[model samples]
Structures are given as structure tokens and as C-alpha cells.
Target: MYNSVSEKDWVEAAHPVSQNVRSDIAGAGCDKPYFEPLIPEERPDIDSPYFVYFGRIHEDKGCKTLIEYFKHFKQKSSNKVKLVLIGKNFMNEVDTSDDIIYTGFISDQKKSFYLQNSIGLIIPSPYESLSMVTLEAMIEGKPVLVNGYCDMLKKHIELSHAGYAYFNKEEFCDSLNKLFTMTEKEKAIMSKNGIAYIEANYNWKVIIDKYKYVIENITKP
Candidate 1:
């Protein structure tokens, strides 16, 4: 079983025998897979608070680039949006500012709170099999800004219309600007679209059904 389409392709290329097996795509489900009942609740103004990057803080994860693009955005725009980093740091060169906060190794409960309140989630990693953090953010009705080099992440953004994908610094800054300037109604629509997409594609019920089908086929005579 593969967690993503890209993973399946990679495995088949590396091991020819993988082609004979019932290779399938079963995406890693969100940590908080179930959506909350939609009730009228006050959410923070989109431009008032911050955007978040929650994952391993390392060079491969593109933490440094994310920080640089965020700084560039803040310097160019009047928007007071902050960037919050939530994970353990493996990168030595990262620095924090009044606009950037590092909350190293937060609890899952705290992580969910940040996801729920943030303007959006930024995943700068250029490589991912499947990003659970991105799905978790969507479950909370938040948009995601992902790196375009990763086909899996790009596919998620395109199929769901849940967020933006950036391939360069200019595109990264542009996406941040666009997300910040969106109207409340537009943000709400994006959020709704993301939640619906996850429910249809990544929810446990859908994943379980896929697994059952694969198992039944393999077990059949």
C-alpha cells in the first residue's frame, strides 16, 4: 500500500515486483479526521492574526525559505500578518523576529488551536508523500499554501481548490498577498471547499472503504 500516487510510482520503478502486487493509494488520514458540526462561531479576522507553518523545522522541509518569503512579504506589504513556526528545529540558521514566533514542539491540542485560529497553513516542503498537517488544517476550515514542486501537494490544492501553490519566491509572496487580501466571504468559501474535499477524499470512511476493496480483491480466489 502506498500513501500517495507518487509513492506508488516510485515503488513500482524501484522494484518491478511491486507492479504485480495490488499496489494502491491509501492516503494518510488527518490526525483529526472528523469535521466538527458547523455552528456559528466567531473566528478571528483573516488579516488580523498570523499564518502558520507546522512541521519539522529543517532545510529539507523548506523552513528557511518559508521564513525568507514571509519576511519579504512583511517588508513589502502593510499587512501586519505574523508567521508562527511550530515544530522542533533542525535548521541552524533560522531566526525569529517580532513578526515571527517559534513555539518549538507544541502539544497536539495546542497545535489544533493554532490551526483553528490562524489565517492559513503554509507548507513549504518540496517533498511530501502525503501531508497530514495540510489535511488537518483543512479539517479546521483553513486554507493551505504549499510548495508547487511537490506533485502530491499540488494535486491536493488543484483538486480541492482549497489553497495556493508556489514554485518561486515571487509566487510565494504573491500568494501570501492574495490570501491576505481575500474578502471574508471568499475565505469562508475556500474553507468550505477544503472541508468538503477532505470529507469526500481523505476521511476515515472513504479510506476504510478503499482498504476493504483492496483486501477483498487480494483475498479472492
Candidate 2:
């Protein structure tokens, strides 16, 4: 099974020995309570009007590039938006300033709090098998901003219509600007679209049924 179509394609083309690829993205099932949106009173002390990134703070994950792009956005945009990083810091870099706050490995509750309230989640990673962080944000009815250069990330945004994808600094800055200026109704619509997409495509029950079908077919004469 392949975690992404891009990965499957690469393996088939490069290996030449692989065949009959079946796609199986990461299953989406979680404790309902854990993912439920928190009230304003219950949210942690994160700055409002922010975009969040929840993965390793490593170069490979595009953490450094995200920072540079965000800083560039801040310089020209009038919005007081911040970028919150909520994962372990592998770069050994100091978490600095209110503009780019680093929580450095927060709990699921707090992470959910950030995700549910933020403008949207931002993923700059150029490589991914399956981005569980992106799926989790979608499951929580939030939009996402992902790297368009990554086939998997780009596919998710295009298929879901619940977010934007950027291939470079110009696109990245422009997408965030659009997100900042979006109206409440527009954002809500995106939220619903994201949730519906997740339910239809990633639900574990659906995944299990697919797995069972594959197994049965494999054992058949």
C-alpha cells in the first residue's frame, strides 16, 4: 500500500519491479473529545489572528523556510498575524519573539486549541508520505496552507478545496494575504468543506472496509 500517489509513482518508475500499487493514506480516527473545538475560555494563551505549524522544527520539514516566508509576509502585510510552531525543536534554534512563537512540543489539548482557533494550519514541508497534521486540522474543520511543490500536499489542497498551496515566496505570501483578508462566512465554508472531505475520504471505518476488500481479493482464486 502507498501512503501517497507521488510515492507510489516514484517507486513504480524507479524500481521497475514494483506493480499493482494500492493507495492507503493514513487513517483518520481519534478520540472525539481530544479533537473537539475548545471554547475561547478554554484555549491556551496563544496570540490571536495566527497561522500554526505542528510538526518537527527541522530544516527537512521546512521549518526554516516557513519562518523566512512568514517574516517576509509580516514586513509587507498590515495584519498582526503570528506563526506558531508546536513541535519539538530539532534545529537547536532559540524560539524567539511574538512574531514567530515556538511552543516546543505542546499537548494535544493545547495543540487542538491552537488549531481550532487559528486562521489555518501552515505546512511548508516539501516531502511527506501522509501528513497527519494536515488531516487533523481538516478533521477539526480548519483550513490549511501547504507547500504546493509537494505532490501529496498539493493534491490534498486541490481535491479538498479547503485551503491554498504555494510553490514559492510570491505564492506563499500571496496565499497568506488572501487567508488574512477572507471573511468569516468564507472561512466557515472552507471549514465545512475540509470536514466533509475528511469524513468521506479518511474515516477509519471506510479504510477498514477497503482493507477487507483487498484481503478478500488477494485470497480469491
Least lDDT summed over 10 consecutive residues: which range in candidate 1? 37-46
Per-candidate clashes, comma-separated? 0, 0
Clashes of 2: 0
The number of the candidate with the highest lDDT is: 1
Clashing pairs in 2: none
Which segments of candidate 2 are over 4 A away from where they belong?
15-42
Q: What is the lDDT of residue 207 in candidate 1?
A: 86
TM-score of each: 0.85, 0.87
RMSD of each: 4.2, 2.8
Clashing pairs in 1: none
